[model samples]
Structure formats: C-alpha cells, structure tokens
Target: MNINDIKMVGIDQNTPIEIRERVSFGKEIKKALLKFKETYNAEVVILSTCHRSEIYVYSENIALKTIKDFFIEYFKVTEDELGQYLYILTGVDAVKHIFRVACGLESMVVGEDQILGQVKNAISISQENFASGKILNKLFRDAITLGKKVRTETGIKDLALSISYIAVKFISDEFKDLNDKKAFVIGTGEMGQIAIKNLISKGTKVYVSNRTHSKAVDLKKIIPEIEVVPYDDKYVQIARSDIVISATDAPHYTIDYEKFIKVYKGKKICMVDIALPRDIDPKIGEIEGVSIYTLDDLKKTADENKKKRIGFINVIEKIIESAVNNFVNWFKTLAIEPQIKNINKFADVISEIEFERVINKLSNIDERDKKNIEIALKRVAKKMSDLMIKHIKNDIINKKYEEVAIDFIDENGGNI
Candidate 1:
C-alpha cells in the first residue's frame, strides 16, 4: 500500500480539446482498461470526459513512463505530440489530484456536478472489467465520498455550471433573449437532456433528435411542449433552428460540414457541440452567419462562472485536502495491518500457553478461578500488544518506520 505505487498520467483543461478528443476512451474505455490490466498486470482506471482524459495506475511494477508509452501507442500519437500536453503525478500528488477532480476543482467549470458522476462511472467500469484492484478501489470510493461531502457542505454548487448549462448560457448570452428562439438539440443523453431543460427554462421552443427516437419521445413525455424530430430528419430541423446543440457519444461527426452546408441557409444559427469527439464539424464554424462552440469554447463562460465561485475555492480545497490526508493515513495504517495481526496472534498464543501452564499447576482451582486467571492473562497480553502496535503506528506516522517494524517481526521468528 505504498503511496508511490499510485501514479496518474493525464491531460485536463490545460490540454487542447482536439487532442483530448483524439485520446478519449469513449466507448472503448472498459476495453482499454482491460487491455491495461492484461499488459501490465496492474490495476488501472481511465477517466475520460469532454474536458479530460486521465489514466490512474496502481502497481509497483508500472511506471508513469510505461503508462505514458502505453498512451502514445494506444492513441497512435507521437511522443512529441503527446508529451507536452501530459501531466504526470505520483504518490500524494496523484491522491490529491483525484480528490480535487472528484470535487470538481479541476473542472473547467469549477464545481460542476457532471464530473462527480463521471468519476464514479470511471471506477465502476474498471471494477466491472476487473481492471481495478484494492488500492484504486479504495482510492476511488474515498474520492466519491469526498465529492459528495464537499457538495453537501459547501456553496460551490451555487455557481450552477455544467457543460450543458454553460452551452445554453453561452448561446443565451449571444442572443440576449431566448423567449421565442427555436432550439434543436441532438441526442437525449444526460448532457442533451440538461441542455433541453435549460433551453426550455429560458422560454425557448426545444426540439430533440436522438438515434433512439423513443428517448426523444421520453423527453417529450416529460415536457409535453418539447417536440421530437426524427433522427434522420435532424438536418431539416437544424435548418429551422435558431440554435442547435449536439451532445452525443457518437464517434464520428454527427453533423458533417458538407451536409450542414447544404441545409444551412446562412440564417445565423448558433451550434454548440458539447460532445467529446465533437458532434458538429469544426469546419462549420468557418461558414459566415454560422457560429459554433465546443467544449473548448465554453471556457469563457466557465471563467465567468469561476469568478462567482472564487470564494468557495478555499473551502472546497480544505475539504479535499482533509479527505486526501485521511486517505493517505488510511493507506499507512493498512500497510501495518499484517504486522498488527501477527503481534495479536503471537500474544494470544503466548497467553494461552502460559494460562494452561499456570492453571495446570493449581491443585484446588475452581472453574471460576481458572476463568478469572485466564481473563487476566489474556488482558495483559492484549494490553502489551496494543501498546506495541500504538508505538509502531506512531513510528509509521512520523516517517520513522518505512519498512513498518518488519525487522522486529523477523527477529521474533513470527512463523507462529
């Protein structure tokens, strides 16, 4: 359970969205984690979202460079191309990074709630794929707990920022009024649904298109006024929309530039692509009277939202720091558990042996007297063992026993 065994290689808000999109695990995240396990025989979890792609590995056999090289080879990107964008973290740094991320401090929109779920999903997928082991399982579970705690105890959620919310806000800011605007949202996933609700709340008429029409219909059921456009005819609906937002997990461009150009009447449409791989083509932004925004473009709105939550940063950071220290201390305590168990076992064996010897020597000892003597002997042994364990733990906490009193156990011939 050495902290050094945990390492993270990642690129977050600092990296370019295009680069992130190229490296995202997407639908293959579970597969990639499985492959990581097969290759390194280590615990690994991949957290890929629109804003970041992180690989967390827990194993003495795996180096950060090994994971970096794995990324280069897996993403098929050259070293120079990927090297400059990566952030490598180890030990406590890695621990703090995950905690910060789970708490949404690392998000472009600080305190965004989506990332918490994404973090949960990342570890869950790894667990389901048998890719995450003891350390990561504990690490992620602790992170999730801290995430919930921060959200519950802090005012960071007052910022009320998310990719979906910000995407709509960005568009609403552009138009100044969304009361009568027509919004065509592609996809009915979490992001898309949130975007649709945001649009509707802005007094805008919302039309949704999904590959699964029933999902769109499901949205319509929630908001009867919401219209469901057939997925195949989404381009036609886009032509009539004042604003179009795409938030889907599709691999390829959902709205191709050429196809969009054919339907685009140059009527001044605002398109927001909140998808990782980018649902809308980048080239569409070049067309006159057509404005496009992606996850990267939402940074301006995120910056504004960050100002609103600046005061909460310190509070959130304190919570995260406390959680990180707790996790580290837990790992430290876990490291010496075997030694503690051995000591307790040794004490019990010696107490039982001495108790039998003394009781055997007593001629008129009743069952009650023998029981009291046995209890006294066991209690003495337990107290001694507890004191020794307490000192060992203090040594561990003080950084005075890196090998965790293993030498003492070895000297005692602890085969018992």
Candidate 2:
C-alpha cells in the first residue's frame, strides 16, 4: 500500500473461533489482494492467522469496506453480524500495530517466539500477490530486531510457555515428580508434538497416538525411547497414562466422556485438552480426581506469565515508541529527500548557468574581488533556493502536491 495511509478490518479474537476458522484459508491472502485491487485505488495485504484475519490496505475506504465485504462473503456474515468484532486503524497506528504483532507482544501467549516466524512467513506469502514495500520491509526488520531485543534484554522471553508446554505443565503440577509419571500425547499436530517433547523433557514416560499410524510411529522413531500406541486404543493408553495431552485436527472430539469414563474410571487423570474443538469432553473436567485443562486454562496460566512479563513489556513499549517515532521521522524524510534532491539539482544548474553568465562581467576586476563577487551571488541564490526547496518538499510530504510531484520529477529528472 501507500505506506503512509493504512486501513484495516478483521475477524479478531472477539469473533468466535468457529467463525474465524470457517473463513480461514491459505488462499485468503491472494484472493483478498486480487479482489481489493478491483474496487480500490490501493495496495492490500491480508494478515490471516488462527486468532485473527485482518486486511491492511493503503487505500482510504478500501481498507475497511473491502475487508468487511470479504468477511461477509468469506465468512457469510452480514455487516451487522460481524462489525463489532472488527477494528480499523489508519496511518502510523496501523504500522505500530503490525510491529507489535510481529514482535509477539500481542499474541495469545505474550512474548511468544513463534509469532515472529509466522509474521515473516505471512509477509513472504503476501508478497506473492502484494509487496513488502519499503515501509513494511523496514517495519518488519525493526520488528525482528525488537523481538531479539526482548529476548535478550528482558526475562519475558524465558517466561514464554507455549500452549504445548502449558498443557504439559498443568499435568505435571498434579504429580509430585514426573520422573515416573506416564503420559500420552494424542495426535502429531504441532501442539501435541511440542507437548510430548516438553513432557519427555520433564522425564515423563511418553507415548503417542495418531490417526496416521505412521505419524505416531515416526515420532516414536525420532525419539527412539518413546512408544507408539494405536489410535483406536487411545482409551487404553489413557487408562494407563497419569497425564494425557490431546491435540488433534479432527472434526470431532477424540475422547468423548462416555468412552473416557469406561476406561479411566476413578483413575487419577490429568488431561490437557489442546484442540480448539476440544479433544476431551466437557464433562471430563467434572470427574472427581480428574483434572482437565483446555485452551481456557492455558490462558489463565499465560495471564500469570503475562503479569511477570509486563515488567519487560513497558520497557519494550518505550523502545517501540522511540523506534517507531525515529523510523517514521526517518521514513518521512526519505519521502521528502527526493524532492529536496530535485530542487537542489535544479538549483545547481541555475547556479552554474548564472555563474558562467556573471564570470565574463567580472573578468576586469581584481582576482580576489572577482572570486568574492562570484561567491556572494551564488550564496544569495542558494539561500533563496533553500527556502523554495523546503516549501515544495513539504507540499509533497503533506500530499498537497502528490499528483503533480511525480510528474514534476519525471519532467525534470527529479527521481534520479
């Protein structure tokens, strides 16, 4: 987009996860960019992640209208239906928001490291249709740098416990020592595998189960010391497991309460449900001696970490504020520099032509006096030139001469 002016619309966290997932697709970015170009004189980039689906547009109305239209079409929701969940920010605020997101400061888990990678990947994919313009490129570069700063300069980085680790931690807290505690991580999804790795790190006996037997077996092969349980026999594994972390991409619950109660009756079970659809049944949490935690529980734990991480975040915010201000100032100057260069180039030509014109008239004068006259005339010209330069460049920066500025540059080689 134009970099200076930005508009955004989104299916944010306030929207239900089901609705967000329904509209979510890998093709959303490409489709949004293509469709946006039709109705708006602007550039569009779609930022779609599990928690949020937002479109940042350089065009004025397109940013809000185009994205809302897409939401209606993509999610099949009316303006009245989804408007409350969406937010739009313009100009520098939008840029600052993106930087915060890229830095992981706005994540579900505060100070997460994965979001930086996700932001970079999304930026790359969007570039297939849109572009990471100088503005966005510099914004992302600063974001990555800020992420590194947060990691090194703050204890917040260490405090980052992903949903995966949190799930395993919930289970581990129940046991006096996980050294002998048995656990089963169902599914080979990123969350499940991460939970397993974290569990194994805690000295728990780990087993894996997945619909794809190869996936479970592959995980076991990679770990070597782990076990691969049959997907159908998950309840059997659950019965033996002191802790269970279930995170599957399945359309339905993997462990319904009826099946779970049949195998795990009265067993001291610590279950961590990592799936959004919920791999474990709601009733399971009510079972006596059964401790079950879902994404909700993870948020609570994340909230605690966030409180501790807050100390560093205020400092990070200061850095972000200073960095963003400095970036914008430098960025604004970059836009104005070309015009300055243009005016100066023109001045240099006038100075050379006028100097040559006056040189012949001063030939009869003493050498020192002739030089003094030349310098005085050029100095007067330069001062006048400087005043006009500032006025013209300011007009460009303020978009007063935006249309004619490019034409003026093209006509006079100002772009060079």
Candidate 3:
C-alpha cells in the first residue's frame, strides 16, 4: 500500500486544442466526474490546464481501459482516432508526475502561480459528491504546502516572479501612507507606465514629469486630473510631490542630490528608481529618509529561491509515498467489500434451508421461547458473516482473493 500501488495516465499539449478543449473539465467537470465514478467505479483525479490534461486513478490496466472506454464512449471516438496523442503513467511514475505538477515544475510557463488554485478547486467538487478517497486528498494537500514553501525559501522568485508586482510591493513598503500623496514619473517607458498604473490603482494622485511637456500633457488628457508639471521646474516639482519614480534614459544621473538638495528642506518623500547603469546614486541610499533599489537588489529574494524548487523533489517523494500507502490499503478494502457481500448472500441461503426444515418443530416450543430461539439463530448468522469478512480481507491482502473467488464462483455460478 505504498508508492508502488496506484496507476496513472498523462496527456500533454501535443493534442490539438480542439481535442483538449473538448476534454476540458472546467464548466461541466462535475458531470464528467459523476459519469467516471458511476460507470467505471474509479477513484479518479483529473488535472486539466493550458499545457496538459492528465488522469490519475487508483486502478490497474484493466481499470485504466474502463476509463479510456468511458472517454471514447462519451466522445464517440474510434480506437484509431483516440490513439493519436495520450501518455499513460503507471505506478511510481504517476506518483511523481502529480508532485511535479502541484510544485509548478510542469507548467507551460514554469513557476506560474494560478495552477495550484485550479487543482484545489477540482478536488473540492469531487469531495462534495462524497466520492474522493485517500489518494487525491493527500496529494493535493501536500502540493499546496510545497508550493508556498517554494515561494518562501527559494531565490526562484527572481527568475519567475513578475517584475511589475515587485515594484508595487517596494513602493507600498517605502511610503507608509500614499492616500493623499501625489507622484511623478518622468519617462513613458513600459516600466514607467506600469509603475504609474500600479500607484494610481492604489488611490494615489499622479503627475507626469518630462522634458517634452506635450507627452506629459497628453498623459494628463487620459488621466484628466493628473497635473503635468513642466520639466524646467523639475527640482521644485520634486519638492512638491510625495513620491517620484525616475525611469528616464539620461547620460548622467538624472537627479544628483547636490543640485537636487536645494529644493528639499527635509520633507517626507519616496523614490522608485528603475533604470539601467543606475538613475539614482547608490550612496544616496545613505541619505536621511532616502531608500534605493539597484537592479540586483530588486529581485534578490526570488533569485535565492531557485534551488528550493529543485530540492523539493525529496519532500514531494515523501508526501506521495504516504498518499500511496493510504490509497493501496483503501483499494484492498474496496476489493474485499464485494466478496464480503457475496459471503452474506451465501449464508442467507443456508439459513433459509434450516428455517424451512424447522418450521414444524417451532409449534412444540412455547411461543416466547420459539421467538427467542429465532433471534439467537439470527445473531449466530451475523457473527459468522463478520468472521468470514475479516478472514477474506486478510486473504486479499496476501493476494489470495483470486483463488478464493475462483472456488466461490465455480460453486455458485451455475446454481445462482
């Protein structure tokens, strides 16, 4: 009941978008899960995204065929047509595949954040039907925890995290309250536009500061209330604004503190410096109430996390191993449940025969004693039923259910 137990099947982006969209589990996923569960008797987990659609089930090739049959039957597909693109993973490979996906290693854009939430939502509906078993529950829970850790401990963030988002966080942390603040960004670069968009969305008033006042004036037309401060009065403009984001391409440092200090007579302000060969001085970081982020410092935390995602393989293995143990043990019980019911059916037949034989003898005993005698017989039958189930469960785990079933079927098939 460990990692060696359950089987898996995988499919990738190689399939046509038409086929992939047809199989997507978003809008009508519940309907598909219900059909898969009722028709195939599968403990199924389906992961569908832009890059791949994988099916993981706690069944062998026979069970897998039943699932494939359901898909073909549902889609009305011929065997040859279905054969074009599908990847199947069984045993340990299936276990590892899910771990990688939850960890974000298998994404079309690696380390993208949205897939984890999508995985959780799919499992939730499966559980609402009172259908999900031990395997999926363990795999998904472990995946979520591992994803959070990958973000927290690794420098992978520098390589993978969004640049616009990092800039937003830096601005908010530097300026305690920007509610009443007015900001100015000098350039019309993409980064400059992104910075302005983020600040305004957070309720800060913005002014465009540039040498060609026409571009700044044009920007003011789109944002009607944002005042356009003329570039000639740049130092005076810096004195008037609470936040300044300098992203201009000037030959020298655009805002040297020597000339710029003349306007600042110790007022609270913030700066967002995001230009190459540095728009702002590194030593300016030492100025009172002044802070700076060189290009390297901006994404340092994300860069530190790159290794954590790689090492997460071991942690993922451990979680998947634990999940497999629970799945196999539960699957063993699933196999035994039907055998237990059959044994009950056999005992009921035996009890009926004895009852018919004793019907005439029931008149000899007092009515009360006869009733008690019947209850005792029923209890005896129930006890025997319990014992047989426990014994069969043990036999199944030892891989002897086939022989037991063969004998029972041989004896019962013709008569039943």
- What lDDT does the true structure give each of the candidates? 0.85, 0.72, 0.64
Error of 1 at 372 (Å): 9.0
Q: Residue 35, candidate 3: how far off, in angstroms?
A: 2.1
lDDT string, candidate 2, 1-416, tens digits: 24446655676656875566666654567666666666564556667765678776654345455556765776676677565676777677887887778667887666666667766666676566654455555666676677777667875755656878667666756786899889988889778867776677568889888999998887765466589898889899899988888889888889988988888768788888889888888898898988888899897877788577767788878877876776665566565566567767776777777877887765566778767866877787689768876666666656687657656755664642
Question: Which wins on lDDT, candidate 2 or candidate 3?
Answer: 2
TM-score computed on alpha carbons, candidate 1: 0.63
lDDT of 1 at 386: 89
lDDT of 3 by residue, 100-176 (tens): 67656676435555567767766787787755677667666666666665645553333444444456556777776
Please state every model's RMSD to the true fold in angstroms.
Answer: 11.4, 11.5, 11.3
- Supply every candidate's count of residue pairs whose N, Cα or C atoms clash at under 3 angstroms: 0, 0, 13
Report the lDDT tens digits of candidate 1 across residue range 102-141: 9988876577677888999999999998899889999999
lDDT of 2 at 406: 54
Using all chains and alpha carbons, the TM-scores for the candidates as numbered come to: 0.63, 0.55, 0.44
Count: clashes, candidate 1: 0
Off by over 4 Å in 2: 1-4, 38-41, 60-63, 130-132, 161-163, 166-184, 187-307, 343-416
Model 1, CA-based lDDT: 0.85
Residue 35 of candidate 2: its Cα lDDT? 63
